[model samples]
Target: MAVIYLVPPVSYTCPNNTTCCDDPTFDTSVFKRTIATEFHLICDKSWLQSFFQTLFQSGVMAGSLMFGIASDRYGRRPAVIVAVMLELCTGIIAAFMTGYWSFTFVRMITGAATGGIMVVTFVLLMEFIGTDKRSMFSAIFHVPFAMGHMSLPLFAYFYRDYVQFQFAISVANVIVLIYICLLPESPRWLLAMNKVNEVVTILTKVAIINKMPTDTIRQAVEQYHINYHVSSIPKGSVADLFRTSNLRRNIVVMSFTWFACSFSFFGMAQYVSYLTGDIFLNVFASGAVCFCACLVAIPMLTFMKRKKAVAICNATCGVCLLIIAFIPDGILGMVFACLGMLLNFLVFIIIYLYCTEMFPTVVRNAALGFSSMMARVGSMIAPFVVALKPHGQWCAPVLFGVLPLISAVLCLMLPETKDIRLMTTLEEGEAIGQSSRKIGTK
Candidate 1:
């Protein structure tokens, strides 16, 4: 949302020319100083807006890979701290940057950190949650993201200046830092890492919080600790994800799902630009709608298996969007488009849960990291997809409608994760839903 807001599409106007200026000026009534305005990135240099986005997304792609490994290698808590610190530092630096080259550089690094925070924090959350309550927690997890999306425009509306807005958002990381500090290390990660003492401490703390029996917690931890050491789960690698047929299929299918979700979700948001509403209000409303979708998803999670949810949402969203391309721009058209948008958001939430439960604990973050990197790739392509507006009005919607349907078909090929335990070893992951054939086996 900040990315779109950073280049205000409506705030500037032509002062003298009857038709919008040949060499457009960024002079508004309030003198809005966006990156577009400050850099005079109007007519010819307009592609720079997409370029800036690409650079940031490229950073996110790299960061997801790097941090995913880092968390697996170092620890989730440490990796999160490092990622957050880098994000804070680069964001602050970007606010002060005057040179376009320098500012974009900072944005890239900041994006990397942001990506790290995103993938790592999610893995951490899923690892902490038990499967029975996973749906509620995962759905609730997206609330802050939607709220931030809703809040960015509010910040942009009041701050108006790029510098002030940049700095203000940078400071929001302080809250993340505090939250990280207060979190207990994931007992799942700890157990897999053979840090049973730490796991015991974390569970003991949890027992204290829930007012459970500490002795029971400690003895249970001891039994698990002894079993863990006896049948220790070996660490995992990205290569391992591809070696086993089941795990390999899961990752490949998930990668496409992630790509489609990112591509379509952002495409849906940007596609709103073609609509007749106020862009700023549209942005806020879009966020609000997504938040409501998250809330509504709570009940849907009760009955919908992960695979079924994704398939249903994707198919329905695709049909609604296809309908949107034909209809006149009216309340009915808007309703269909909004429904597509809402379903895309639900796919995102469900897919996260799907991904978390499919992979084993050892390589879970790595799998998510790779999927997120693909998601970044999808998002990078989204603007260009939206830019297809010049070719045909139907180009964007048709593609949007088609991609999710393809993903819906792919969703069926995936094994169900609803009743399956979160895998702790490569063997466990490979064993999941083995009702499907194992091709390319050695």
Candidate 2:
């Protein structure tokens, strides 16, 4: 995301004496060296700015598909490790790159690795949690995501140079790399894949970690698998996603929801540059606001059905965005914009868990990956929509606002999955995702 939003080296008046920075001679003393300054992404070349953003997002989209499929085929632990390594390597490479194309190429790969980390880790986490606890852990899982956003401004403030910033962020990946030895593969995934022995060992470790009786937990799993005929459960693939009518509908609906969320979130994000305030403060405040929303979502998810919560909040977000579209950029507009972001992020948490519940274990990563891919598409198009602001100030907001309302309506087509067990088989996945019932029914 930071790669996509590099400050283009452009001429502008200084606040103190209205002194203009000439094009050829970019004052690194005042502006500092960025990709924009280093590669001269300004003036006639400024058109390439958003294009680069779109390309980086494309990298993320590709990564989501590649890693999602790879994790299912191989294992979550390996895929995640590979992505982390790639992310670390790419970040370091980009820092020293002298050519714009080379830097962009490296960043696109970095974006892809990031996309893989997000999609794979999410599925793995969901698989480890029980039905009652998924809501809590799912919401809590995203807190670090918010903190990642918060840290961007904090580090950027100290590291004014792009190279320093890259090193600062990339260095953090080394700490994550240390977790490889400690990281466990999903037990459910192992069972679903027919790796019974591996799953039992993992479960035993989990029991010890939780201070539960290990023998009791292992016996329960063994008995459950034996009684249920776990071997009959088929492995799912990308093609299997479309094998059933209901699963197809579910994927389509979920993909659209993911798309709308990414589009609106990034659309509003572009407006941050236009807001009246110190750039660092506005960005930092935006991250803080989102972090607070993550805390609020923990309770909200417990009280509301997943589908209902997403529908209600997205509609409300749309309304707020509509209001922002008609108003001038001021205190009122900023308030509504923040409100819209809060609601949008809240809906993201709901639909993410909702999508996980709607899909089967075997193809869950593939489905989530595909959905995330569509989200990248939405993000790719967002810059173009925001650029339309020159034609009509309301164009971006109006487009961004209308999408969520449609997605809210589309949410009705998805089955509610508030307290349902994770579906291990495609048959169960199809049945639960297609059928809607009263709140109390399991």
Candidate 3:
């Protein structure tokens, strides 16, 4: 599609003393169909392509805030179901869209739905799993995302038509929507809402399924209620994240880290198109590297302190990007680029685990939502940064390299969260950071 959109320049004869070339025009003879060709999204209107992509991130930003609040107020299961339904409907609508503006509108809505599903699902999984197993499960959870990225090129290869590809992706949501019906609401959420009877009922059923003795399950639930005092903690608001001194600093640093991580990761991914090679091959290579990074991340998260691991990942990623900026464009540069992407991908996995552990359960969803919203800002701007490649090849890579390095340094200010109990209250969370600092001083 990109190749077709990049129409070849044609020569025109000059009548008098000078020779001139006509404006490049789409060549339908080579490739007759594509959104670009169909809409004449070429020449001066090419910026619209980037604009269309940006709108999706904008939607994601909006959706994160919307569904984050909704999940906290309603429940994770309901929020996730709504998001899936939105994606299913909007994706189909986007496929049949004939006008460019209409397609862009649907895509923006689709992006929001995608964001809602992702954030809520992450919180749901973290809430259900044991703290010790979270890092491993988080890594496992990301496998499907990496697989989705890797599968896109294969889908495009087999079904070259844009409409067909859209339908193929959209239809999978139907299966998800059906599956969502069977999922139970988060027990932690029920407990937080002071719905003890509901929590007991759910835990009893879970115990029955696992064949655990009913007495043991009852003892565990009684112990949890006494230890955490879950009923006393008030429902959290978004403002609670900023109400205290330590939390304010934590939010500031983590939000910036999210922005940096996302900006660099997406910037590198988008720039693959500009690399000198088959676009499909470049995309596949990038996805493969990211998948490998996910595998490597499993043990890293299991053994290493989350803060140190993230700092190291960010620094190494920065170095790789720097090398790519200097090396001549070819296999070597592509190698460095892929390496940078791999390390950045590791950083992404570690950060998700870190963020999940950092905040208390009360505001966990809201904090994650705010952080993701900051990330969308980074992602939104990434395309424009990549677009700067026409002026200088190194411009985008240098920007991407520098941000993560800054993030690496900033990471040192955040506390290590590995092996600690997930905080259930704001005061407890603030104390953890303070205690870590006091220990550091010794």
Candidate 1 clash figure, as a count: 0
Model 3, residue 55: distance off in Å is 0.7
Residue-wise C-alpha lDDT for candidate 2, range 1-442, written one tens digit per residue? 4652265224444454444334465665533777777766665676576777788889899999899999988889899999999998998888878788887888899999989998999998998888788998889888887788778877777887888887788888888778864789988878777777898898888888888887676677777677656688876788898988999999999999999999998777766656666556666666776788899899998989888899999999999999987898777877888889889888888877988888878889999899999999998888778767767878888999999999999999888888877777787778876556532322
Candidate 2 TM-score versus the reference: 0.93
- lDDT (CA) for every model shown? 0.81, 0.81, 0.80
Alpha-carbon error at 184 in model 2, in Å? 0.9
- TM-scores for every predicted model: 0.92, 0.93, 0.91
Per-residue lDDT, model 2, residue 349, is 82
Report the poorest 10 consecutive residues by lDDT, candidate 1.
433-442
Models ranked on lDDT: 1, 2, 3
lDDT score at residue 425, model 3, on the 0-100 scale: 77
How much is 110 displaced in model 3, in angstroms? 0.5
Candidate 1 similarity to native, TM-score:
0.92
Shift in Å, residue 241, candidate 2: 1.3
lDDT of 1 by residue, 1-442 (tens): 5677666554456778754565565566442677877776755676777677778888998899889988987889899988999999899999999977788899999999988998999999988877678889889999999899889878877888888899999988888887787777778888888877888888888888898888877678678667545247777778888997888989999999988888888877877755666666777777888898899788878678788899999999899888877877656766777788889999999888889888888899899999999988988888777767667767777888888999999989898777555667777778774854332111
Which of 1 and 2 is the better model by TM-score? Answer: 2
Best by TM-score: 2
